[model samples]
Target: MSFGAQVLGTLGGIVVATLGGTLVYGAIRLTVGLRLDQEDEYNGADLSIHKISATPERESLG
Candidate 1:
């Protein structure tokens, strides 16, 4: 193959790989976000690891 054709092919491959990776990452993030949202709605906090308040009052600095 010609040098130009090889370079173009390499670039195309890289672009496709990057897009696929980005899509996978986005899908994972969306799934996680949805699960978390559902947990918040049903249980008020994430319970996979431990049960804790989603919001706790913090000491104010005055």
Candidate 2:
């Protein structure tokens, strides 16, 4: 396959895999009844799910 075709093919494969995985995951999440009552709405997934902040408070950084 040509270089362009190869890149396009790779991207196409990635897109398909990502979309399929997302659908499967969504269905599982729906069945399991896992909801994110995110206390750290401003903060993000790292702090919310992992219980560890990726970035320390600015004062702590100083």
Best by lDDT: 2
Global lDDT of each candidate: 0.73, 0.82
Model 1, C-alpha of 14: deviation from truth (Å): 0.4
Error of 1 at 19 (Å): 0.3
lDDT tens per residue, model 2, 1-47: 69999999999999999999999989988887455565666677787
Per candidate, the number of residue pairs that clash is 0, 0
True-vs-predicted CA distance for residue 17, candidate 2, Å = 0.4
Off by over 4 Å in 1: 33-62
Q: Pick the candidate with the highest TM-score.
A: 1
What TM-score, computed on C-alpha atoms, does each candidate reach?
0.52, 0.51
